[model samples]
Target: MLGYQVPSPDEAMLIAGGKNKGSTPFRVVTGHGAFVLPFFRKARFLTLSMMESEVDERCVTRQGIALNVRAVIAFKVGTDEASIVAAGQRFLSDQDQMSVLTGRIFAGHLRSIIGSMTVEEIVTERQKLATEVLDGSKEEMARIGLGVDALQIQSIDDGDLGYIAAMSAPHTAAIQQAAQISQSQARQAAAEAEQESQRAQAEYARQTAIVQAQYKAEVDQAQASAGQAGPLAAAKAQREVLAMQTELAQRNAELRQQQLVAEVVKPAEADAEKTRVLAKADAERMRIQAEAAASHNRVALDRMLIDQLPLIVREAAAGLNGANVNILNGASGLSEMAASLVGQGLTIFDSIRGNLNGSSAEDAGEPDAPEPERPQLGDGAHPRPD
Candidate 1:
């Protein structure tokens, strides 16, 4: 086995590719004969063609045909996948001009193709598009027997999507600020309203208290006035009585004059009031008696109607007979025939008074008015009942 030198993956790959890509590898062991064994057991299956070494014609690769170039390539190859391999299998040597040039051409093509692509499309559809690229590139990369040893999608530059992200930052901040401002305003308004509501409640309570106090004051004033009212009124009466006594002493003639009011004037007035009440009562009694007579007369009139009703029926019957309805259809046609009968029967009444007595019939049984009231005797409070 060749000496194993653990290093960075790039360095290890450099050692794997026979220190390819200008990677200066550290030698792990010194020379007993200073020979590289070309330990590429993993590359045993590949078809290798090597040029004859003029110094050593027998120095052919394990699966090699001799070629003009055999110089080792130093490389730390990068790819779209894992570790690198040596030239003719996974890489090309520096002195293998055809292979190196072919590699450069293929690399330029790969770089161009990969560079042309969007990283999202490359990464998101990695398996499909990447495999397609790899497959399509295989023969081209192996044009000079320099097949790709490994591949890696090491660093994908998802180019400059920061513009979209950076642009959204301000918008997000503005939205958040607007939301916070709205929320703060709402909270502030709510708080202010709450405070105002509390103030209103307090004001209402204060006003209510004031009203209650005022009402109590009014009630107390009313009670105090009520308590003083009787004594105040009695004192006023005594004062008036004293004044009246003084006035009576000062005006004896006036006192005598006033006495006439109590005797003559008051008695006359009382007599006049009593007369007026008695007259009113007598008038009312006479009116009631007249109403009673009228009622009796109405009752007599109603009684007379019973006898007259038969006479009316007889006259209507004769008229209906003249119409022949009573003989032909009888009372069944009475409603129609009765009008004719009534017209003819009216002439019978005409022999006595006819419609000329219609007015007198209305006046009959009406009561004569009562005689006017005469004087009587009573107090003036109300008229006496009958």
Candidate 2:
């Protein structure tokens, strides 16, 4: 088991000291089982995997400036029978030395590439420098049974000379100035925008105040009109009331005029008719008296007395009708009462007729008697003229 080896995928197993090994000089084993019978077999491992190396070298650039360049190179043993055999023959004893040898080889090529380019070109165009180094070292690496995968220039420094920094100063200052200007412009624009916003707010506030004032003025005017409306309406109603009162007064005056016309005119008309009738009666009486002066005076008196008889009876009956006579004994008391009333009425009539006859005889005897001798007649009695 100690002499029996199984190689890994990244390794090649080389064997010597067997009948097939020394006679064949060497045999490669890869990714399979291999038995080395212990004493008769000797085996060594050679790596075929990828490897990387770093090279730091101080080289003179085309500008005669010394620059220290650090670079990394990726390389591997070629996947071919010839390359694997060649690598195995050389590095089978010390597999770790492959990276060491690769570093030295690329160091020389990196120095050569940097020496051909300027310091500016070496610092700015690192890929070009790496490409040149890779191309220059390609043939030398292949002869050593290696293949280059990638080459990168990690850093380039100009030792004590600040040539690279000096070259970038103007551009760096210009960039700083541009950044400062952009920041200043942004601040100025923000200030201007803030000023504009404040101005707009002030304008809006002023306009709002103006509008409020106008609105308040309108409200005050409307309130004043509203305050005046009650009195104005009341005054208008008062005018209407006054007009109605005036109409009532006019109506009352018309009614009063009509009442006065009825009271004064109707009574005056009745008095005028009565006066006319009285005047007519006086004329008829005077005519009768004049005619009676030619006839007998006693006969005229007798005629007048006969005409007054009915009026006297009616007055007596009217007086009796107004009298209140209570009868305790029904029909007999009433009959007695009626007889007494009839007797009194007859006696009154006879006394009136006697007075009238006596006055008529005296008037006939004294036809030229004085007015003081005439007497006034009582109710229901006719006048006796002298």
Clashes of each: 20, 0
State the number of backbone clashes in model 1: 20
* lDDT of all predictions: 0.48, 0.77
lDDT of 2 by residue, 196-295 (tens): 9999999999999999999999999999998999899899999999999999999999999999889998899999999999999999998688557735
Off by over 4 Å in 2: 1-3, 17-25, 207-386
Q: What lDDT is obtained when candidate 2 is compared to the true structure?
A: 0.77
Each candidate's root-mean-square deviation in Å?
33.0, 23.0
Number of the top lDDT candidate: 2
Steric clash pairs (candidate 2): none
lDDT of 1: 0.48
